[model samples]
Target: MTDSVGFDFARLSPRDRYKLLIGTVVPRPIAWVTTVDPEGRPNAAPYSFFNCLSADPAIVALGIEFRPDGAPKDTGRNIRASGCFTVNIVSDALVEAMNVCAVPFPPEVDELERAGLALVPGVAVASPRIAAAPAALECRLHSFLEIGNSREIVLGEVVHAHLRADAVDDRLHVDPAVLDAVGRMGGHGYARTRDRFDLPTMSLAEFTARTDASDA
Candidate 1:
């Protein structure tokens, strides 16, 4: 027997559908994105709807939402205008600063400065990155996707990356404990990535052998 209910997305309101998606998506990666306004003023913002879309081309995607008036947010508008952005990893230590950047500020205000964060110039892009971030990816606009009047998806090809020397190794493996990155949850919630366990994938022979052994 099962106890399950279904809410058809087609019949639900956008707000309700969004609530369901965010609530059920578990923890989502946070993109501490940095961009420059048309006049070259730096801007920093955080988005939970972001992830690495492809590794072959090293591409990342950011799903940016518009304002209540249907105006593009600073990050999306800046990316559309400049064709470049930087994504900084939000570690536990940087969570407060990342949240400060999320506040709605005027176009002239520099969110990075307000958060009192240090910055470093991007190696391959005009946008800068947070100096204290565990990792940062400099990206150029690859494409844009307009799902509706409410959201815009920005696909960017990562041209360069900077990793903390103490966190990443020459073999390119990252120590999760050292990185201590944070993630976003539904509504005003966040989660830490420190708690993790590994379960290796088994081959078919190994699976069959384990199953047979268990049956005995």
Candidate 2:
């Protein structure tokens, strides 16, 4: 005998549905973003619900949420003011600094300075990228998507990219091992890309040939 269990989200509350979503998502990539305020102070934050939205347009997205009183976060405000931002890929080596950048400091405070992170000037934008980040994408705001009361999605077009010289090839193939990227898990947890393997697909003719050779 066996038993099965399922939860009907339609009947459940929104908060419950959110819990299920985040719990089941397991690991999500973190985008360590940097933007400059109107006064030119740098702001940084880590967002897990972020990913590339389009390749042709070279767009990336970050899902941001407002505070309880519906105030926009520093990231959103900075992006609106400057129209540009830099996204640095989080790595295991930079996790501690990345967490420090996540602190909700006052608008006048520069999070990068607070976190003791060094910065390099972005090629296509005024925003600076984390000096130790394995890779950085410089972007300009393309559009904004309002999902609900608290959630706002910002889509940005990639204007420039910088990768550690040894991590990429002449053809721009990035070596996963060199990146050492880390991902966010549910509730103060993270995962590393250290455990990975690649499997190549075989053609039908190759499979048939192998089968014939085995019988012989």
Candidate 3:
């Protein structure tokens, strides 16, 4: 195999590099977010720059991008206005519904209704959680980190959580085969979380004993 020369990221435009980076990062987890406007209209959108920032405090974050004219997107605006939102985990069975939320519909348009997703009222916040999702985190805005023109990293504390009956066990180990979670994979590509394996970690003494046993 021949080695290729590296391309300077600084030389390329931000948009170009962003596309390259997002495209190369395979199987990103999708955050199917739900928010409400000042007028009580529901809004939903899918963002991949999302993850669990904290577990004890139950904090999840989303890196929201601004419009081309350096304006906040609908999701950002709604969250800023209401201070509450829901992060719904996307599954293979609900990929189509998740895509429906991605449509650039008018502010008045209810993506949940368009996607035919059921809404379960949240406990700690006014925002409603998606019933189709196996797990939903009802969050309240903790803080916002402004990155650049039109980009903000939103940190939210999960005040309430809803898990599907069949998804979790007494030990809280979620069954992947049952969840069938889907992940983003650059462009229009996506991946299923079905293919999984387990690797158990061993203690130092156990490792040493295993080595000694192998030698014997």
Model 1 residue 130 CA deviation (Å) reads 0.5
For candidate 1, the 10 contiguous residues with the lowest summed lDDT are 105-114
lDDT for every model? Answer: 0.94, 0.90, 0.88
Q: What is the lDDT of residue 76 in candidate 1?
A: 90
Top candidate when judged by lDDT against the true structure? 1
Which candidate number maximizes TM-score?
1
C-alpha lDDT of candidate 3 relative to the true structure:
0.88
- Whole-structure CA lDDT of model 1: 0.94
Q: Where does the lowest 10-residue lDDT sum fall in candidate 2? A: 17-26
Clashing pairs in 1: none
Candidate 1 lDDT, 111-184, residue by residue in tens: 88899998898889999999999999999999999899989999999999998899888899989888899998
Cα TM-score per model? 0.98, 0.89, 0.90
Better of 1 and 3 by lDDT: 1
The count of backbone overlaps in candidate 1 is: 0
All candidates: CA RMSD (Å): 0.9, 2.8, 2.3
What are the per-residue Cα lDDT tens digits for candidate 3 across 20-43? 888877778888898888998888
Q: Compared with the true structure, what per-residue lDDT tens digits does model 2 show for residues 8-115?
A: 998999788877777789788899999988888888999998998789989999998887789999999899889999999998999999999888877887778878
